[model samples]
Target: MSTMTVKRAELKPGEVLCSYCTARCCRYFALPIETPETWEDYDHMRWYVMHGSCAIFVDEDVWFLMVYGDCKYLLEDYRCGNYEDRPQICRTYTTDECEYDNDGTYDRLFETPEQIWEYAHAVLPPKKKKKKKKSATEVSHQKLPIVHI
Candidate 1:
């Protein structure tokens, strides 16, 4: 039997953090949203997508409103200025499960209002139109049975 040797890869200083120069994880945050069930709900979501740096996505059946904006703590070099005293949420975030690793995990992502509108047209029911009622004058104009005194 022949024996084989394996070597582990080594990372340079700040290599893991430096690799993600764009700081994608620090640039955006998503808030949970109720699944749109009506045209109004879908229309509101379309309005959200119409704004700059705003988007919507679904992951594992959960929908979210994603807002893109750089974190106040992120420095110009893509480093966190308050790394030592970062929030618990930030501290808990792991690089292995970051957006940089899996950018295609979103089931549906809408980057523009047109995209959301297209989806709405496919999934939402058509709006119903209310019929106009006949006026009293129009009703009086109809032929009526003659009454004799």
Candidate 2:
């Protein structure tokens, strides 16, 4: 019997806390969003969220819209370019609402694209084309199943 091992990545909390790295999170991480539901609505959402590095989030009562881009003042060393005179939001940001404090887990929550799709799909109708049943002879003859759309 072969034993399989799955390796999990370890994060450095100290590196996140002590290092003055470029504000990568602010630069590239996405905002989450809450949406109105309709097939058309979801179709539009599918179009939008299907792109590179876009995400939607719903946490408790809050919603977020995420897009990938960097903060204007983020420097190469992970230091805030304007640390001394950072914007009010960044300056007042508390670790309490931070991913670092939370170990960046959407672990308790569904974080990936597929997870969100499953949630959305549950609320929507089945998207797969309904297939017509075939006789055993058809199977033996290698006939493709006919899909009824």
Which lDDT tens digits does candidate 1 get at residues 65-123? 99999999998877888999999999888865566545466889889888888898898
Q: Name the runs in model 1 displaced over 4 angstroms.
A: 1-21, 131-149
For every model shown, the clashing-pair count is 0, 14
lDDT of each: 0.79, 0.56
lDDT of 2 by residue, 45-70 (tens): 55666775665656664555567677
Which 10 residues in a row give candidate 2 its minimum summed lDDT?
1-10
Worst 10 residues of 1 by lDDT: 1-10
Query: What TM-score, over all chains together, does every model reach?
Result: 0.72, 0.52
Highest TM-score model number? 1
TM-score of 1: 0.72
